[model samples]
Target: MTTEITIELDINGRSETLTLDPRVTLLDALREHLGLTGTKKGCDQGQCGACTVHVDGARVLSCLTLAAQAAGRPVTTIEGLSAPGGELHPVQAAFLEHDAFQCGYCTPGQIMSAVACIREGHAGSDEEIREYMAGNLCRCGAYPHIVAAVRQAAEMAS
Candidate 1:
């Protein structure tokens, strides 16, 4: 028999309760259980940053973080990044203005990581931005534009 445990989580600024298999990943819990599909399942491994989310304000790989391990921490997915009433986060706006994505498969992760990168003080230069954002791989090869977006957002935040 499968065992399930109930846990309460603060997600996207709201309180959430879930009864789930202990083995379920935070990524699966967010996407499969909570129906927040913005955090993609790109490689299903930690190798890809596509599953990135903010756990207590730090970027984390949801796929690699067990749901139980995230209990009681406030989690923020891409859907939660925007201000209430549908205003875009500055990073999101910068991405749009910079044309940072092509097919956009890696966009949510890129934006999430970019926000953290800037907040972490890693967006100081183009090289630094590249190094900091190295984990998020864009198949469309939009590195230049992505860097521009991050820089723009960083400047805007300053």
Candidate 2:
């Protein structure tokens, strides 16, 4: 049986309504239903931060979030970080400047979490930022550059 639930989502800057299966995860809904594939699915069990996104301006693991539960909340994915005109967000720019990503598989989630880390005042120091950003792993062992990028983005944001 298919249960259609209508959810109002503030995706990026636009408001949208979608009818979806209640069992669908926010990650799946975003990628499969809405075609927002920027949020990658790594572990899918929430262990990996590859599925990170912003919900109501806070970082969350999209793979673990229920689409129905996110109704009426603002969702921001990596694609949304850039303005419609194609200007990169400060964090995105910093990532490039620091060469924070190698394989690029985890870059989206890392950037998303980094944005939240700065916004939440957790990026105060290199050690502190590294500790806070520990959740998002970079298999390429780019932690140093990742930390630098986060610091750069934080400085730029300030």
The best candidate in terms of TM-score: 1
Query: Tens digit of lDDT per residue, candidate 1, span 58-94?
Result: 9999999999999999999999999998999999999
Which 10-residue window of candidate 2 scores lowest in summed lDDT?
Answer: 8-17
Please give, for residues 6-117, the per-residue lDDT of candidate 2 as tens digits. Answer: 8887888778788888899999988998899999999999887999999999999999999988888889999999978999999999999999999999999999999999
* Candidate 1, lDDT over the whole model: 0.94
Model 1 misplaced regions, further than 4 Å: none
Q: What is the C-alpha lDDT of each candidate?
A: 0.94, 0.92
**Predicted structure with the largest lDDT when compared to the true one:** 1
Q: For residue 1, what is the lDDT in candidate 2?
A: 88
